[model samples]
Target: MAFDPDAKLSDVLAGGYDLNNRLQALLISRPLDSRGQEAAMAFSQELSRVFMLSLSMLNSNAVAPEVRSGNSSGVSAPAKDKRARSDNGEVVTPSKKSREEGVTRKEITPSPHKDGYQWRKYGQKKIQNCSFSRYYFKCNRHRRCEAKKKVQQQDGGRGRLPPMFKVTYVNEHTCHELRAHDDAAARMASPWTASRHHALDGVVDTARGGGGLFDLLPHIVGGGSAEENEAMVSCLAAVVSGSVPSPPPRSSGWPAAPEASASDPAASFVPPAAAGRSASVADDGAMMMVDDTGVSWDPWWSFCPVEEAAGHQLVTNQNHHRDMHMDDAGGFADAVWPEHACGAWRRA
Candidate 1:
C-alpha cells in the first residue's frame, strides 16, 4: 500500500477497508440530495473532528474496532458498515448485547416502567421471527415526554405465545415524573403484565443478577408446581425478614450463634403457646389453595434485593447499579401495589 503523507486523516482512514474506515464511511457518507451536499459534508467533517479529539484521549486499553481488508472472494460484505470481525475473530452484533460495557443503544426495547408519566398505544408492528406482536406506545402525558415502548410477545416454548412478554422502553424523555407515569401506564396497558400479576397471586418467583434487568422467560411457559409455590412463599418471607440466606459460612474463626449452656433457666425460655401462633400465621398466608400433590422439585439460588424484587432472578451487590428508571417510581407498580403476603420472600 502506498502512503499519502499529505492526505487528510479522514481520507486516510476511509481509504483502507478496515473496521475504522468502514465505520467512518457509514456514519459520514449518507445519501444527500443535490442541494444538501454542502450541509452533509460539513456535518461529516464535524463528526470526524469530534472522533479525532476523543481518540487522542483514550488509552490503548479502550476497545476500538480492529481493521482488516478483504479482496473479492465473492463473500458479501456486512450490511451495516459500522463493525467488522477482528483478525482474532471478535464479532460484534449491534443488537441486544452491545449494552454491555457502557455503550447505550437507544434502539432496543425500552424498560416497561417509567416513573410517573402516562402513555397510550399508538401503533403495533409485526416483526419477523418475533412470536408476539410489537405494541408501540407514546407518552400521553406531556409533549415534552418523547418516550416510547415496544412490547413483544414472548415465545411460550410449546409453540404458543406465552401470556408474558418482553417490554422495551426507548426513553429520552426529560420529564422524570412523566417517565415514571408512562412506566406505570405501560404495565396497565399490557395484558401480559396483568397475567404476571395473576400468576403471582398463586405463585410469585423470579431470579436476577448484577443489573436490575431480568430474564423472565423461564417461568412464563413453565407452569408452577406445588413445591415451587412453597419455595415462592419462603423466598418472599426471607426478603421481608431482611435476611438473605447468610452466604454459606466461610472457613475461619467464624462465631456461631451463642447458645444456652444453660445452668440458667432464664436463658432458654419455652413458649407456652408457640404451636397456636405458628399455625395462625400459616393459615393466613396460605389463602390461595393450590394442590401440593405429586410435585417434587429441586432448590435454586438467586439474589433478590427486596427493593428490586418486582421482576425475575436478580443478584444484588452494593456495586450493582440498578437502572435509574427502575428506581424512578418503585418498579412495576402492578406487582408491588397492595403489598400483602403474596408468597415467601427471598432476599439476597
Candidate 2:
C-alpha cells in the first residue's frame, strides 16, 4: 500500500486529540501514586509540546505571507481589515516563538528528572572520582522510539540522604503506551485504600448513633451505682471547667480546724505533728480543720492549696452530700462507702 502524508498526519492529529481528552479525564477523576502522577504530568507536558509545534507549523505555512504582504501594501486596504489581519498573524508568531523558547530552556536546564516511564538499561560508565556508575536507558515501549536518557549520581553527597542523579534526555517518545501504564499504576497505588484500612481499625460504628460518651463510660469505669455515676460526671464537668467542688460539712465525726483566708499561704500548711486529720475550707476563703495526729501530710496534696484561689471556686449549687476520706497512710485508698464509687471518683 502507498503511504499518503496528509492522511497519516490527519490520523496522528486525531489520535493525539483523543489521547489528550482521555489524559485530562484520568487526571481529574482517578487517584494516582506519586510515580504515576509524575508520569502523567510529564506526558501532559510532552503532549503540549506536540500541540504547540503543530500550531506553529500551521501558522507559518497558512498565514505568514498574506500578513507580510498586507503590512507591506502601506494602507491599501481598510484600517479595520489590516488591523484584524495583523492581530491574527503578527501577534501570534512572536508569542509562539517565545513559548517554544521557554520549553527548550526547561528541557536543557540541569535538574532532578524522574518523569515515571519504563526505560530499559542499555549501558553504564564510571566517571573519575565518582562513587557510582552512570546508567544509560532507552524507551523500550516501541522499537521505533528514539527517546534515550542518561542518569548519573553527583559525587560527595551520601549518608541518610537521597543520592542525586543527573538525567539527560536525548529525544522525544513516539510510543504512546507510557500514559496508559502510568494511569494503571496510579490507580493501584491510590491513597484512599490505605485511609480506608486505617478507618476500619478503630472507627466507631457511628451509623447506629450508639458510640456516645455516656454509652462508653460504663465499660470504661466498671460497675457503679447510679448516684455514684451522676456524682462522678458532675465532678468531672466541674474539674474540666477548672473549678474545684467544695467538700461537704464534716458529718463523719472528724474535728474541725481554724478558719483562714485562701490568700494566706499559712492556711494550707499542715504542722509535722498534725497530718492524719481531714481538712476543709469555708465558702468565704476560710480553712477549718483540727489536727488529730502528729503524722504530717504534704499540705499541697492533702487539700486544694489556698494559694490556688483562682481554681478553688465553691460549687454551692451541688446538693449531693458525699463524705471525703483520707487514708491513715496519706494516699487515696478505699472509702467507707462504695469501693467502686471511690474508684470512679478518683478517676474523675
Candidate 3:
C-alpha cells in the first residue's frame, strides 16, 4: 500500500514513514530483477502525485475553469468538468492544471512552488558561487499568516530535465486556507455525480425518469460535439460492462495538462451530462464504486484533470508502466485515493 496511490493518503504517508512497511511489498529489487528496475522510480512518481495533489488543493490562487469566449450569456457551461470549449461548445474534460506556473510551463515545469497556499515573493539573493539565485517568499497575508519559504536552485538533471529546486518552509500557516480550499474543491468535484441524496432535484428528475444511456450522453459529456459525446459514451458503456480494457498505447501519451486547441477535433469536448449521470451526487457522496479492488477507473476518470494529468505522466517512466497499469496495476495505478477515488460526486 505504501507505493500504491489508491491507498488512503494517511495510510500512504504512514507507510512511507515506516522503516519497513507494506510499501516494501512492492519492492522486489533483486540483483538482476529487470521487472523491479523501475519500482523505486514508480513509487517516487506516485508519491509525487499524492504530494502534488494535496498541496495544490491548498493553493488559494488556483485557477478556476476558464469560460471560453462565445457563450454571450456569461452563464457557465453545464459541464464544469471540461477545460476547453468547442466552437459548437464541447471540450474534453479533465482536472485542470493549476495555470499557476511550474507544471504548466511547457506542460512540464521545473518549479515545485505551486503549493496550495498563496505566497508573495519578498526577497531574492545570489549565493557566493551559485549560478542561480536564492529566492524567498512569505505568506501572501504576512500579517495574519506566518508561513515562509526559501527556494534554492538545484543542478539540472544532467540537462535531461530542467533545474530542480530545494525548498524549505518555516512555521505553520495560520490562514485557514485549507478549509477554504476544501470548500471550493468540493464545489468543483462534480455537479452530476451519482449519489442517492444531496442531488439536484432537476438533475435527478431528468435522469431516473428520462431516456436510456444515449439520452444521458450529452449531459454527461458537457454538450459540445456529437463525436466527443459518442466517444465518451462508448467508453462508459465498455466500463459499465466489467471487462474494461486499457486503451492502446500511443507513441506519445496525451498531454497531461493540455491547453485547449480550438482547431483540434480531439481537443473538443461536449457539455457535461451532469443531469443524466449525477442523479443525486452533489458533494462527497458515495462514489460510483464497481469493485473493492481499491482503484476505480470508471468512465468519470477521463474527466478528472487533476488525477488524469498526474496519473498519465507515469507514462514518462522508462518501463511503460502506465500501459500495463490497468491489467497488472490499477488503471491509474491507484487513484485520487480519497481525494478522487472517493470523490465524484466530487473527484470526477
Candidate 4:
C-alpha cells in the first residue's frame, strides 16, 4: 500500500512498514467468494475509466482528439491504427521510424530531471524478444550520486506503447534527493491536503480502527479475528471512498506531469486508450492481475497531479467505454456515478 496524501506523517512513520505487508497480502489473497471478483472488477473499471478519460483530456490539450482536427489543420494523422491515448485523453501519433521488427531491447528514459543531476549516455543493448533498442545513461556528477536512465523507442505492433523511459537511481543520491524534492513539493501543493492529513491522524487516534494492519497483528502479537479483517477492509474501502466526495475540478499548472504536449517527439509512446470498445474481460482480468501482482497502492494517496488531471480527462472516456461495453454482463466497463445514475453509492 502507498501512503495517502491525507495521512499524517507520524502515523505513516509509525505503521508504514505494516501497511506494505498488508497490501501484498491483499493483492494475492483471493476473496472467499465472488465479492473479491466483483470488487476487483469494479475497482479495475474505475481505474481504467479514469486512466482512459485522463489520457483523452491530456491528448486533446496537446494533440488532436480525432482525425478531423488533423484534417482541419491541414496535417494528416498517422496512417496506422497503432495510436495510443494520453492521460489527458488525446490521440498519440506514433512514429513509423521509431521501431523495428523482432527486437527485444526496451529503454526507460528518465523524465527531464526534476532535481539537478546531469547525465551522460554510456551504452546501448538489445534484449531478447523485444522490438526496441535500450540506451543507458549514468550520472556524470562527481558528487557520488549514481543515477541511471534507460531510453527505448516504442514497439509498433502492440498498438499501445509502454512507458518509453525508465530511470533507475543507483545506491547514492539518486532517488533520495528526488523523493525529498517530491516531499517538499507535495507539502507545498495545497494546505487542504495537509489539514486533511492532520484530521485523519486525529481520527486514527479516536477510532482505533485497523485498516490493513489489523490482519498482521495476530501473527506478530495475536490480536484480532476474521471479523476484524472484514471490518477493516470494509472500513478502508469506506474511508478511501469517502476521501474524494467528488472528483477533483480542473486545475492549471499542467495537472498531469512531464510537460505533456502533442508536439513532443516522445509523446507517441505513452500508453493511452483507443477509440474502440474497452478492452475485453480477458484483457481487463489480466490488467487486474497485473495490478494486484504489482501491489503498488501509492497512487491511492500521493496527491498525484497526473492522476487528478487524468480524472478530469476520464469523465469523457468513461462515458464512451461504458456506452460501448453496456451490453456485456456485470456492466463493469462503464463509469457511472452510482449516486447519480445507479443509486448504488450512497454518500458518506
Task: Give the lowest summed-lDDT range of ten residues in model 1.
Answer: 255-264
Per-residue lDDT of 1-348 in model 4, one digit per residue for the tens?
A: 344545443334334323333333445666536776665555555445444444444335442243222232222446456565443578876455333311122213322222223344456566454454455545443223444544443343121112233333332334335444544576699755655433422333223344446545444422222322333445456688885122221123111211222112132222221101122122122221112122212222112222232343345345433333121111221121111111111223
Q: What is the C-alpha lDDT profile of model 3 across 100-204, one tens digit per residue?
A: 211111111223333333345557676665554655656552245656666555434222122334555555665456434444566678534423222332232
Question: What TM-score, to 2 decimals, does candidate 1 have?
Answer: 0.23
Per-residue alpha-carbon lDDT of candidate 1 for residues 146-252, written as tens digits (9 for 90 to 100): 56555554443121111233444554444446534555676689856645432422221132221221233223312222222233445456888967532212113
lDDT of each prediction vs. the true structure? 0.32, 0.36, 0.36, 0.34
Compute each candidate's TM-score over C-alphas: 0.23, 0.21, 0.23, 0.21
Indicate the residue-level lDDT of 198 in model 2.
Answer: 23
lDDT of 2 by residue, 34-126 (tens): 976986787677676556555555445453333233221122233333222232255333355433422111111112222323355557666
lDDT of 4: 0.34
Better of 1 and 2 by TM-score: 1
What 10-residue stretch in candidate 3 is worst by lDDT?
A: 339-348
